[model samples]
Target: MTSFDIVFGSFLVSALRSATPLVFVLVGETLVQRTGSINLGVEGQMLVGAMAGYGAAALWGDPWLGLVAGAGAGMLLSSVHGLLTLAARANQFASGLAVWMLGFGLSAYYGAGLVGRKIEGFGTWRGAGLDDVPVLGPIVAGMTPTVLLALVVAPAVAWWFWRTRTGLVWRAVGESPEAARAAGLRPIRVRLQAILLGGLLSGLGGAALSVDHTRTWAEGMTAGRGLVAVGLVIVARWNPWWVLPTALLFGGAEALALRLQTADAGVSAHLLLTLPYITSLAVLTLTCLRDRGQAAPAGLRAVMDR
Candidate 1:
């Protein structure tokens, strides 16, 4: 009824929409970090996935197939990193950066030419059942199905990381690679699996943003959500459970910025837009200082030499 109430209601929905990509990236990053491998090319991965996903969807008439193709693309890119980092014993940071740059070049080359190429018959989440709820309409609670999928995955990921036997091995590799080796587990193998899975999930995040959420292919559509999510993993102390809520918090700040701009409050839009990233930076810096010992993975180096 009131203008402020309407703005606040819209903000919540917008926050949820924005949070979906963050949740997807953080969950995947959570597993990779837990297994002692680091990838900084998430932005690149998402961009590539966006292009690949849209291309696949446009070809297949089924968005689900596009998502699968997108995920495969992500895994392929990450597998290269896993080989370089774990097998060749390359520096994780450097190798990850290389991957990022490679993706950057490839995406820009392809994305520019593909603009306005429509994907006919791609399913959209805009008019699902959620829009009918009196309190949970599009202005308040209507959300893309990808958001629901991500919310479900978050808890499942937390449970798997903390409670399963495979998870134990995953954690062991992160905490003590030598111990994991001595325990009859292959460090390379465990880390490879983690890397692949992480990349897959992240790619799905890209797919969701490109195909399901926006239903369009824009160059650099993912923006920097992937990188922010890497910080989210660090801020959550590598805890999958906590990553969900932290993502929501960051998303909320973003939603507020968008609302303020829409309301034309005379505030600079760029400043409001930077709030989420700024908040993530503050959280990461504070978490690093306050929970140094607890925040880092067992053997993770700030800069991996080998």
Candidate 2:
């Protein structure tokens, strides 16, 4: 293979790896928002998940357990948001921010002891017999199961939403809660379920970040990928099927930043790290301008309208 092919292949692999966590968050938030709930606490949830997952893995020497603990932690936090928004009828935006703060503060406080520690987590997946092929070979090989799982998750979620009774009910709750209630569907109950499910997946994404991707814990390690994902939902037009490409778009930009840092270039390291955030902002701006009438769920749009 040519040198350019090698470099591009490496970049593609890195992008997919980096995009895994984002994909997890994107799919999760997509589910939550589809139920007419906006969760901005993803950053905090991820942080807590990272810490909890790493701690569990360290304690039990089992990465899978760590992942479960992380998901549980996320669910615990998201439940608070659900209670406040659904049960108490609190402002959804305010409740989300409160949850976000709780996650951030709680994670930082609890994770202080676990910082700088490491544990054995998931390893890379090398597809059998693919290493010998050119170009596509390297790109397909060396991916972790987490990344591969995310690849499958996007399509699975798309299928679930487009072709299932439960999925239809979930979407119906988001589209019009009143109509749902009249139709004998409990919108509040459905939203709670969606939020819990989203939290589970978000926590898994967090675990993937600390336990699988970095294999270590750090305060605020999620680094706004959660918020970036909020904008991506808009870019995706609220369709689960679109989440994959949008995630890869951000992932590609991040990979480019990493590659640029390794190369002999004039850009500052700090500036290089901003590539992902900048790309997200640019995409959000363009998407908002192009699709002013967002394809958001009816409930979400109503909330936004008020």
Candidate 3:
């Protein structure tokens, strides 16, 4: 391959890899927010998942088990948020923040023993023979299995939200709990389902980080990607279908930052590292200015209305 071709291909590949976790979190957050719940606890959820997944892989000698354990951890924490917000009628945002803190403390306290540890984590999926092809080969060849699964699942989630009877009920519950109750559907129950599912996905993303991306456990390894995903849901206008592109955009910024760090650019390395967060903030600001809550569910509006 030509030098430019190789460089561009590397950038594309890195973008996809970086975007994987965001895609997972964005999809999960979309599901939760659709049901009128804001999950700011994603940062903590991911951290706990990362620790649990890494510890599981280390203990049992299987990375896949780590994925499951991570998801379970996320669900366990999510249940607390659900109980507080849904059962006790607590403020969703506050409950989410509390969950985040709980997760942070729990993970930090428990994960101390796991620092500097390693596991036989997942490997990339190098499509057989495809790596010999032209540009497409380099760009699409070496993705990890979890990223591929996320790509497939994103569309499936979009389909489920738009093309099914159950999906309609889910939307109905989000749009108006009173109307859902009138229609004989329990809003609390549906929302709890959504929140729990979102937590599972978040945990899976965390597992992907520890098992498929970094292959090691570290305190606060998630580094606010969860919060970025929350902003991405907003930038996607709360549509599951739009999450993929939004996540890609953020991933591209991250990849570019890394690329700049390695290049001859005279920029400060720390400044380059800020690109992803800067991009997220810019997109969030622009989206809010343009949309002004138009994409938020009616149930969410009602919560604000109260």
Candidate 4:
């Protein structure tokens, strides 16, 4: 391959790897929002999930188990948000903030012992039979299972929202919980289910970061990816299909930043690292200006207006 080809290929690979966790969290947040609920605590969930996942992998010597534990940890934390909002009738924003703080503290306390620990995580695909195929084979062989799963989940979620009966009901609840109640559907139950499912996926995203991406544990390692996912969800207009490309855009920015840093491009390392967040902020601003709540679920709009 030529130098240009190598460079381009490396960028593509890095982008895909970076995009994997975002895809999971973004899709999960989409579902929660579709139920007329917002989760600002995703960062906390991801952090706890990362810690639990890494700890599980180390204790059991199995990465898959770690993934499950991570998911469970996230779901467990999300239940607190559900209780405060659904049962106690607390403010969604306040509840979400509480959840975030709780997750942050819990992860830091629990993960302290696991810091710097390593585990055998998932490996890239071999594409053994595709060796004869050409460029596509080599590219496919480089992806880990988590990356492929993230790719599948985006389209699958889109299909579920548009094609399934349950999905329609979920959307209905999001648009108008009162209407759903009048229609004999249980809005609270549906929202709870959405919260739990979203938590499961968010946890999986965290697990992907620790076990599949970093293969190690650290406190607050998720940085602000969860918040970024929340912003991207709005930019996507809560559409699962749109999430794929939006996530890729962020991932590309992140990969580019890393590449530039490695190349010693003379830019401040701190500035380069901020590239992804800057991209997210800019895109979110433009999207909000252009759409102006035209596409937001009615329930979400009501919650935000309060």
Give the winner by lDDT.
Answer: 4
| Model 4, residue 196: C-alpha shift (Å) | 0.7
Q: lDDT for every model?
A: 0.79, 0.86, 0.86, 0.88
- The true-structure Cα RMSD of candidate 4 reads 1.6
- Sorting all predicted structures by lDDT, with the top scorer first, yields 4, 2, 3, 1
lDDT: worst 10-residue window of model 2: 123-132
Q: Across residues 1-306, which tens digit of lDDT does each residue of candidate 3 receive?
A: 787987888788888888887788889989888888888888888888888988999999899999899988987888888999888989877888899999999999988999887788776647677777888787677777877877997899999999998888888988988889999998888899999989988888888888887788888888889999987888998788998899888889988988888885999988988899999999999998997877788877765456
lDDT, residue 70, model 4 = 94
List candidate 2 stretches off by more than 4 Å.
126-129
- The C-alpha stretches of model 4 lying farther than 4 A from their native spots are 1-3, 126-133
Q: Note the residue pairs that clash in candidate 3.
A: none
- Write down the RMSD of all candidates, one decimal each: 2.7, 1.5, 1.6, 1.6
- Candidate 4 accuracy as TM-score: 0.96
Clashes in candidate 4: how many? 0
| TM-score of every candidate relative to the true structure | 0.89, 0.96, 0.95, 0.96
Judging by TM-score, tell me the better candidate of 1 and 3: 3
For model 2 the local lDDT of residue 282 reads 94
**152-241 in candidate 2: lDDT tens per residue?**
998899899989999999999999899999999999999999888878778888988898888878888899988898779888888999
In the range 107-216, model 4's lDDT, one tens digit per residue, is: 99999999878798887766567434555654576778888989898899899998999989999999999999999999999999988888888888999899988887
- Report the Cα lDDT for residue 171, model 1: 90
